[model samples]
Target: MPDECQPLHNINVGVLGHVDSGKTSLVAALSTKLSTAALDKHPQSKERGITLDLGFSSFTVPMPARLIAALPCRELQFTLVDCPGHASLIRTIIGGAQIIDMMLLVIDVTKGIQAQTAECLVVGEIATQHMVVVINKVDLLPAELRHKLVVKACKRLAQTFAATTFAGCPMVAVSAKPGGGDGPAPPAEGVPELIGELVKMVPAQPRLVRGPFLFSADHCFLVKGQGTVLTGTVLSGSAEVGGMVELPELRVVKKVKSMQVFRQPVSACRQGDRAGICVTQLDASTLERTLLCTPGSVPTFTSAIAAVEKVRFFSGTLPSKGRVHVSLGHCTLMAEVTYFGTPDGSGHEPAAALRLVLDRIGQLALNENVGEFDYSTDYAYQHELHGLEGRPSASGRQCQHYGPQWALLKFSQPVTAPKDALVIGSRFDTDVSKAACRLAFYGRLVALLRAEDPSELAHLRIFKLKMRAGSIDRVAPDGFSAVCKGMFKKDTDISLFAGMKVTTASGAVGTIEGSFGKSGKFKVAFPKGIVPAAPGHNSITLTFKRYIYDQNKRNMVQ
Candidate 1:
C-alpha cells in the first residue's frame, strides 16, 4: 500500500451556508450540544440566527485505523467551524473559508439554493476544491420534495459554478434533528459515505517548502484563559512555538505561546491544517484578522505603482468610474478609479490595466487578488435594475480577464505578506496587482522598485508616462536642483535655493524639496505644485508630485 497511510489524524471541515440554513443546528446534532457558556458568547450569537462571528468546536469522527497510535483512524478529530451566513459579513466567511481543507456547504432543502449559496460556493472554490454539498434541513422537507430538491440543488451548483473548477459537485442530504433512539441517525447514512469521499477527494495539505509563511487570519478573538487567539490555516510555510511573528502593517511582532490543530496542543503546525495559535503582545482590538508571519519571509510592499496594463471598474454604468474600496486580506483602502478602459476615454473595453491611487493600505502582497468592497448600494443598484442582489448581470459590464496584470498600489502604512498572491476571494476579473513598477510609484512606501535597473525604470511606461528621476544638482547650500520630463516637453530643470519660494497656480508655496533622485540621466525633485516649469529653460520639466497634482489641468502656454 502507498505510504499515504502515514497517519490519519484530524481533518478540518468548516460548515458554510446562508442565514437560517442549519449549519449551527447541523453541527449541534452531530456533536454534543453547544451552550453559551461552552463557547463563551457575548450575549449576541445564541439568540441570533446569524452566527455573530466564527463558532468553533471539536469532535471526533470514527475512522478506519489507529491515527497517531493514539486515536482510532475510524475516529478522526474534526474541527467544525460554523461561519456567519449573513450577506454583509461575507468577509468573515472568507476569513474562515481560506483555511479549510474541505467545506460542507449546508443548504436548506426547503429554501433550496440561495444567493448565499452561490456566494459561499464561489469563495469555497477559491479557498479549496474539496467540498461536500450538504442539503440540510431534510427533516423539514416533505418526502415527495426532498429528492427533487437534492437534484435541483446539484443542478444549481453545476449551473452557477460552471466557469469554476467545481462544476459538478457531489452533495449529501442530512437532517440535524435527533433520532429518538438511534442516537442521531446519520441524517443521511450517505453523510459518512460523503465523508469517506472527502478523505479521498481532498488533496493533502500543501507543504510549506518556502521561507515566508502566509497565515491568512480567519478568526481573531480573545480567549477566556489565553488572552487573544487567532486561528486560520497556514497557507504556505511552517510556523512553530517560540517563533517570532510580525504584523507588516502594525509593525509589531509577537511570540507564540502555544499552537493547536485539532484541540490537541502541538509544537509546530504546517501548511494545509487549520491551526489555532496563541500569540503574545497583541491586544484583541489590534488583531484585525491579519497574517502572523515570520519577518523577511513574506512579501512586504509599500510604494506607488504604475500598472502598464489596463484595468476595469464595475459599480454603476459602463464607464464604471468612481472611488471604490480596495480590500486584500484584512486591509481596506479607498483607491481612485482614475479612468477605465484605455485611460484615454475610449468606449472600447480595453485590456485589464488601471491606475489606482491607494488612499489606504494594510497587510497586502504583490500579484495578490484584491477586490472592491461591494457596497450595499452597489447591490441595491443591481436590485433596482435587474432584481438581482448578489448576481449582477455582466451584460455590458463583463470584466476583462487577461489573467494577472502588472500594477502598483500605494499604501498609507507599510504592509507585508509572502511574495505569493494574497487572495481575497475567487473574483479573478475583479483583482489587481502590486507589481514592482507600481510599488515604486506609490509615494512613501518602503518597497524598492524591481526596475532598480535605471534603464528598466526609464522604460517602464503606464499610459505614456515613463519612470524617470531627475538629475541632482546642488542648486544652493540648503536647496537642490532637479529636472522632470513630460511627454510633450524636454527634460526641464528646476532649482530651489534653501528657503526659496515659488508659487503655483494652485496657490501653494514650494517649501521643501523633500527629496530628489534620477532614473536615467534626468533629475527629479519633489515640489508642491501642479505644473512643469523651467522659468529659465523654455522647455519645462514637471515634478512627478506636481505632474500628478496637476494632471487634471490643461497645459500652460510656455
Candidate 2:
C-alpha cells in the first residue's frame, strides 16, 4: 500500500528486443540513476551482448492516484522490467509481462527489424500488450542505415501490430552507449521522459470486484532479516500488509507481513504496481514463478478452457503437433496440440491458424488470445497467436484452401465436463482430417462446421450433434458448453431445470433431470422432444432431477 500522498499509481513497463539491442543497457542506464540496483555492471552483459535474465528497477513520476488513502504521496510510481532479448526466454518474459502497461521494444539499428522482432511482435499481439519500438545502437549505424532500419522496423511493427491491439505504438531511435544520443536528443529525451510517457499510456488499475489479489512473481529471494521476498507486478486489485496470499502454482498461502517497491519498504499496492511481498511463514524455496492472490478471490482451476475462434503460429516449419507448455496468469500446464485444423489463412505469410486442446484448466474467457510454443536451440523458433481486435481475423484471402471447414477441436484429455473450453483451428492449408488426428492425439474431440449447412456440425465419428440456437452457449469456434436457463416455451416431454448438467448433444446421460426450489415449486421431468441435437432456433432446456452422484461427493465445479 502506498502512502496517502503517493497512493500507488503504479505503471509497469517491460523492455523487449533482439539480442544486442541494448535492452539491459537501457535498463542499467535508467535504473542506475533512479533505481536501487547497483547499476548491473556485469562483464558478461557487455561481453555476451544480451540480457540473460529479467531486470527490475523503479522511478517516480508526477501523476494522480485514484485512491488517496493507499498512496505514500501523490506522485505516480513506475516499475521497469528488462526482459531478455533472445527468444528462449520469451516464456519467462511473458510470465513477467502479464502486468505490464507498455512494452519498450528495442531493435538493433544495424540489423533493423529481424525475425526475433517479428516474434516479439507476435507475442505482444497475443498478450494484447501496448508497445513502443526503439531502434537502439544508432551510434553504430551509419546515417543511411539508421534511417532505413527505423523505417523498416516501423513498417514491420505496423503490419504485425495491425493484426492485434498495438497497431499504433510510438516509435523512436536511440543509442545507449556513451555519446549515443546523436546531435539532437531522442524526442522523449532522457530515460525519465520515456518513463513518463509510459506512465501516461498505462491504464489505471483494474477493478477486482471479488478476486484474490494477483501478483505475478518475477523474482524471489530470502532476505537476511525478512523471510521470503517475492517481487512481481500486481496484475489487479490491491493488497495490504497481512493479506493472505495463495500461491496456486506452489499451492501455498502465507500471510504477507511486509511489502516493498524498488527495495524500499511500503504498506500497500494496487493493480499494475510492482511489489515485493514478505511472507514470514514461507521460505524462499516455497515461492516460484506464480500468481499470489488473496485466497477467496482466486479463480478455481478447471480442466476446461475457453478460447477465441482462431489460433495462429509464426514458425514456418509448422509445429510437430504434440503437447507443449502453456503459461498464463501463474499457472503453467501441458496442453496438447491436436492438429492444425481450418485454414483461415488470410493475413500474414506461411504460418497458419491451429487447434489446440489444453489437457486441463477449462473455462477460458471469451476471445482471450493465448500463446503457443516450439523450442529450438538457435533461439529463433518463435510462435504467437493473433486476433482482429476482439475477433478472429477475417478468414482472409491468400490462404491455402484446406477444405476442412467448421473450426473444431478435441482434447487429448477429455476436459472435466462442465469446464468451459474452446476448440481452435489453424490458418494453414493442411488436410482437415490430419488436423483432427493431431487434435485427437492431443486429446480433444474434433468437429467440422459446414458453411453450407450451418445447422449441422460434423463430429469425427464419436458424436455428430446438431446446433440448437438456444440450447448451448457457443464459447468459441467449434466450442460449446452446457448452460442452465429457464425454458421460454413449455413442452410436455421436455423439462428444463437450472444448474443441471446436460450431457451429450441429446441432453441425455450426465444430465440433471430436475431442479428444486426452497418453496417446493413445480416439479418437472424430461421433455418429449429432447434429442441428441436440438433445433437451430429452439432453446436448450434442462429438467431438474434428484439424481445426486453421491451424497458426500463434491459437485464438478469444486
> Any runs in candidate 1 off by more than 4 Å, and if so which?
1-14, 30-42, 58-78, 178-190, 204-206, 217-229, 279-285, 298-321, 337-407, 410-416, 425-460, 464-558
Q: For candidate 2, what is the lDDT?
A: 0.48
Give residue 247's error in model 1 in angstroms.
3.5
Query: Candidate 1 lDDT, tens digit per residue, 1-558?
Result: 213322234556778888878777667655543422224253676566357676666565555442324432334556667777776666666567555667888887778767666667655654565677777766665678868867776776656544434545676777765332325354433456555656555333324436666677756778777757887767767777888887665767788899876455777776655677887657877565678777755555543332222211123221222333434555545432222113333223233322222211111122233332111110001101110123313232233232222233434454454443433312223322311111111111212343324443332233323222222232333333433233122332323222333333334344324223442233333353234334543233233211222233332211
Consecutive 10-residue window with the lowest summed lDDT within model 1: 378-387
Position 203, candidate 2: lDDT: 57
How close is every model to the real structure, measured as TM-score? 0.57, 0.57
* RMSD score of candidate 1 (Å): 14.5
